[model samples]
Target: PPRFTAQNHGNLKNEEEKEEEEDRRDILAHRGSLTVRRWYPVGTVLAGLYSVPPLNEVVAPPPGMATRLCFSVEYRHSCEQLMVSLLRLGNLPPRFHGNIMLVELRLLPDDRRPRQAKARRTGPDPEFCDCFVFQVSGVCVPQSTLSVCVLSVEQDGKRHAVGRVLFPLEGELGQAGRVLWRDLETEDDTQVPCSELGDVQISLMYSPCLQRLSVVVLRARGLQLLTDAGVCVQVSLRIHTQVVKIKRSFVAKCENDPYFDHRMTFKLHSQHLDEACLRFELQQPNNVHSGERPPALLGVLVLGPFMYARGPQLQHWMDMVNTPQEPVELWHGLGRAT
Candidate 1:
């Protein structure tokens, strides 16, 4: 019998399963739609969420941020559940694992930190009319996103990410005080698109033996300057929550291709490399592109798991994190181009 609620409408079921469907439908009818208010004095009860300090510690969002995002969540979709055979030997009667699916939702507070909820097992297509508020204070709402994934539970208690939806959070969406019946998208689970604005060549080296990290700013090419005014390149590094700005060098008589032969090293432990990231940024005092767009960012390139990339990104991850001493020189495209 199909255990999920939103299954194939054409699929036929037995008498008992049909009776169960009627009962479930009656329950849903009794339950009304979910609504969240501007001020939830009792958020814990509305969301049905309770956690101890060790398990659900309230980790604040990053600094240099403004505005808090508040939103509600619910799911409506049909997914496949794998039932592992319990019988080890063929002699025993085959046993089918019960139909069970878990929903794990992630509300990213920032690029590096993600606020994930405890997995909720709600059969198939469990639409909780009693919605909960997901509040991430002090975050860039437009930049952040919400990810809900369906997982199949095997008899052995193993879970697999089968299908999911990635939805971006914007300020305007919350103005209505509710997000009603949004269809989840499953496009490789990436919400934002990464652009190849320009190219940058950087070298990375790590020594677990010495617990140190080093990077050399080779050069930048194919860059679009904001204005004819002189521009500068900011070479920097980010390790976990700590940010080390190596130097800000000015490029005089700036053109598209500017050569910045600079190098920086950080005293990093082998463990810190897990959260370490390298960045290349361009800046200018004035706007050059007339009537195109505001020149907030001339160009930016990021190297870390925080920024999503497809296909060769897997190879890029391996070369950047694993391959040491080789000094892999790869052409990195700018993520945000002005």
Candidate 2:
């Protein structure tokens, strides 16, 4: 018995490593806890296919001249497994053109809420089909208000106002993927006349984090139009920077308050960050009206944060009155305890 091997094989290997750490704390206390749900698609698209005339009859840009719109959207995914499942779920936003995808172009605020169905998957497969084709151009800033709220659209029906065009900032309407109002010759310019800027009620809000794209411009009431036309609308807010070449910028102002509300907050602090392209301009100083052209409200870039974490998670527990079970006082004799 005294020859029971090397110290009884180190006491049976420390009793099988304390029984595998108590069976991994009884299988992590019986597991279970994980629930994630995500869906988006909010609709709105009614400019009557570019014939321009019915936001009442366009006459809202005489205060300080501000309305030069150019909005564009062209997304086509009839198949190819839903564009490779929307480019592997990054929601396709980069180069994205043909099998088509431009996704967003901004500037809107009549009442702001046109698009519909911001999200829906309900888990299990859900028969996918996504389609979109929106095109907007500017130059009707009197009283100013242009909105196309389709946050997510492939198909839901009920977006018909079709009546506005011929303001693509005056010229150049060929590039952004091509759609030049039938080669403009000059029928009042080209197209602009459509009514029914009504019936827009869309709602679906859930935020863990990630919803930044808030642009507001309100000065219509009595319209002094930027302080009685001393003229100063120079507002520029361009976004899309991950320091690739370095060109960061941000500025805001409407002055003297006819009405100005601008808020653009996009968050995605990691993966090197950068997916919120914005470009706003209202310079206007060639003596006010060189030839009448300032009415642009292009907007639709809403991808907010819901679960972006590079920081925020710490839990260290172990204090029990400064933890001291056997260290028995080093200065316990100072005044001798009772």
Candidate 3:
């Protein structure tokens, strides 16, 4: 053995300290750090936190409240505009605290401007012949949805959602000069429904040769943010009860409608494809007070195979798998993560 020197002893001590630090980091990483990637067994994916109910069922309104809304939607293809006219409301519920009611017209997937009719005191029925014009140039009206919400103003100057009608703009509904009456659906009075959280457009592609899956976040609309802080999109790839990968898009200014245009790719073996799932979350970082807490999850959209996904989510996944390397894109309504 060589003679021991002070420098040699110091080097050995530093090496030991480095090893200890790395060991500590590894231990902490297993505590659900988003930046770290790990693998889990296949069984975890089968019975995991990602298991959620299919979003195909319509929510029935509460009994004794058969509110209905009459509106006409006209799509001016030549002018690339959509004209919405609020004709009247019938079977309205009784108001509380001497509040008045109003109607809000919103065009989905694009255009965040909501036109509100003047609030007025009415009996069981009210009429508002208000017409609002929205430019729908970039939006695909046939694939979009229109939200007609009836609201009531409280004495405290707060507005509450009385009932809402989500009308799909497709087929005859998408044609110009079409008028219809639809029943308004109501959710729990205590909280806002997940359908009001917003909507997101996602694009997915998988390549078997390389065993890679790519996901792109195109845009989101009608998002309700708590603050003015910017928001980022977080994509989590969870398999076997473990989040294997987490990626985020660049922070963009908070807006009712924001465009992410971010793409994240993951390398996945075809054997485990059936067990893999993707989670899209809108994270609103608290920029004002850094280190105060982690980013808040505004809304979430989870997509997987038929085992957990259904409706449009299942169809989108099948389209991508059937046509490998070809991209499949679709719009999904965001819901509060269960």
lDDT of each: 0.47, 0.24, 0.73
Mind giving the per-residue lDDT tens digits that candidate 3 earns over 1-338?
A: 89865568788899988877776577565655444334322222457677755311222223455787767888887898878877677677766325677776666544334577964446666667678988776358786677776777776766565777878777754455655668877643313333788888899999999999999999887888988888889998988688999999999878978888888999988887778889999989986676868887789988887565754565556556655777766677888879
Better of 2 and 3 by TM-score: 3
TM-score of each: 0.36, 0.17, 0.43
- Model 3 worst lDDT window (10 residues): 54-63
Best by TM-score: 3
Best by lDDT: 3
- The RMSD (Cα, Å) of candidate 1 is 22.8
Q: For model 1, which pairs clash?
A: none
TM-score of 2: 0.17
User: How many times do residue backbones clash in model 1?
Assistant: 0
Collision count for each candidate, in order: 0, 63, 0
The global Cα lDDT (0 to 1) of model 1 is: 0.47
In candidate 2, stretches whose alpha carbon ends up further than 4 angstroms from where it belongs are: 1-6, 21-27, 30-99, 109-338
Minimum summed lDDT over a 10-residue window in model 2 is located at 311-320
